[model samples]
Target chain A: MYGWIWRRLPGNAWVRAVISLVLILAVVYVLFQYVFPWAEPLLPFGDVTVDGASAGAGAGREEGAAR
Target chain B: MPVRLVIRTFSELCITVGAVIVLFVVYVLYWTGVKAADASDGEIHRLQDQWSRGRIELPAPGATASAAPPDATQEPQKSQAPQATRGAPTAPTTRSAPAASAGTEPARRPARSTAPAARPPAYRDGKPFAVMYVPRFGRAWDWPVLEGTGVNTLKKGLGHYPGTAALGGRGNFAVAGHRRTYGDPFKDVPLLRPGDAVVLTDGASWFTYRVDRRAYRTVPTDIGVIDPVPEKSGFRVPGRYLTLTTCEPEWGSSHRLIVWARLEATRPVTDGKPPALRS
Candidate 1:
């Protein structure tokens, strides 16, 4: 993905380098400001608790009570 | 020849340094967000599946229908006919007929009781127990609220402070999310104005809270903002409160930004939609 972006830039080595940096920063800014937050609900990264315990345990307890 | 060789080596060094800097930037700003988003997406799917499969145990009165023990089949009967004699005081036929009819009436009311018993589940650290919605941020401004404020949970979405009050409860329900990285869930929180609705749902009911105050600069050690009655929130007595905290300056965490909201209304999920989401 990044290679495609880099190859699409229009510049010599020095100019390309500067443009690439700016482009990269702009992409990062947009991701932080809009894209990532919008996609947060779809991620699976935060299922574990900080106490070294998994949420599944509480879920299991609820299940047991429920059953 | 020697001078030419040195010149060539100097240019190579510059190229290598520049490449290293560019790679570092990609790693920090791009790669991390990608990984965090992927993780958050997985959790969301799992949560939705659990809800769909009836794994989430509704609290109390609602619990009996889906959670009754095998040996306690009589419990539902008891709830259905509260006036029925335990030891057959009256004619079984005459009493049970009316009790059966009365039982269905209370069953309908349990759906409403669901709200008061809809205490946020005691989820494991990073698991989502509720989803937050801020119409002030637009219709797409919703994120799953994980159970605890651990590093892992914050990376996925908003993390609920462990010691704070439960969502829509009679105390402060404090949460924290990233301001810049790890999906930047609170990136636009600063734009929220007073009276803006900050709503959340736990699959049972919608809890709408109205933003009443915003604090732009607060020290990391300031716990008063998450207090039951948040300082500077303009509230003197205890009430349902929602406190949202994120890093300040949009790029740094030298200080914190706090937004305080008061619970305004709660509607059951079966009620179709809350006013905050009507538009």
Candidate 2:
């Protein structure tokens, strides 16, 4: 997937390297601000309510509870 | 030459996948903390600004007389207010508590004779209502205490369990926070011992609660840990209490670490910072 994007870049190796860094940062920003949050609820860990309603308790996922 | 091209592309693909996985881990462990720190700090500053402007919202005066749980007494009075006004990012929406007991008003109405204050404060779902300080954590450990324990609510800071007592009120005032991430507000819950003070302020008064026991471990299913008189918390009578819960195993959520506390004292902000915080 990334190889295709790299091959299509209209620049020399040095210029492409800088563009690649910027592209990587943008992807990271999107993943952190939107994609991961939307995906977190679908996972079964990070629940702290002690209400017994949370599913999939054995995954051993770390972090705080959200449910 | 064709074989060489295929090998180069395959190697690049493998490296890209590996990088993505590593980035996800960083998101979970590091980036979340940074975001939570920013959110919680903003909440704290906003609360302080309100307090400075004399916009502190104390509990309703009628709440002072009747010592029943908040769900039974407070919900009925505000039942007319639409509980469905949720999802607005900034509005202070009413709580969406389980209204099964909205009826059956307590007969002790005469005890609650105090007139409603100029403006009765409604519990704003998913919004911050107080700031909590744990001296055991550090001289600077503080987090905003928001209402509701929903996934999004706890992301900002500690979440107050709905249906529990108001801060410094008569029943159990329970709050939950993440143990490992989202600023890890309760990261040192296990370190709390008897006599440690968990001080909280609602911009009006300082409430200091004294830890009553070492950290108690229980399953997430055990809801009794936050009861008016929590099981195994060593209290036999109904009284002002505080329950702080976080996930167990330091990293996983299979169980919970509980720290039970009792209200030690309360003082208005006019008196200055509580003694617990001076140290």
Best by lDDT: 2
* Quality of model 2 by C-alpha lDDT: 0.69
Give the DockQ-based CAPRI class for model 2. Answer: acceptable
Q: Per-residue lDDT tens digits of candidate 1, residues B1-279?
A: 879777777887787668655754564467667766776777666655555443553332122233222332223354334223221111111112333434222221111223343354466666787778888777866688887675556767788877667777767888877776666678788788888989887654567888986654675556577777876778898778888877666765456778888878664443335667788
Model 1, position B92, has a per-residue lDDT of: 15
Candidate closest to the true structure, highest DockQ: 2
> For every model in order, what is the number of clashing pairs?
18, 4
lDDT of 1 at B74: 26
lDDT of each: 0.60, 0.69
TM-score of candidate 2 versus the correct structure, residues matched by position: 0.76
Q: Model 1 off-target regions past 4 Å?
A: A1-67, B1-14, B57-121
* Best-matching candidate per TM-score: 2
Looking at model 2, the pairs that clash are: A46-A65, A47-A65, A48-A65, A50-B220
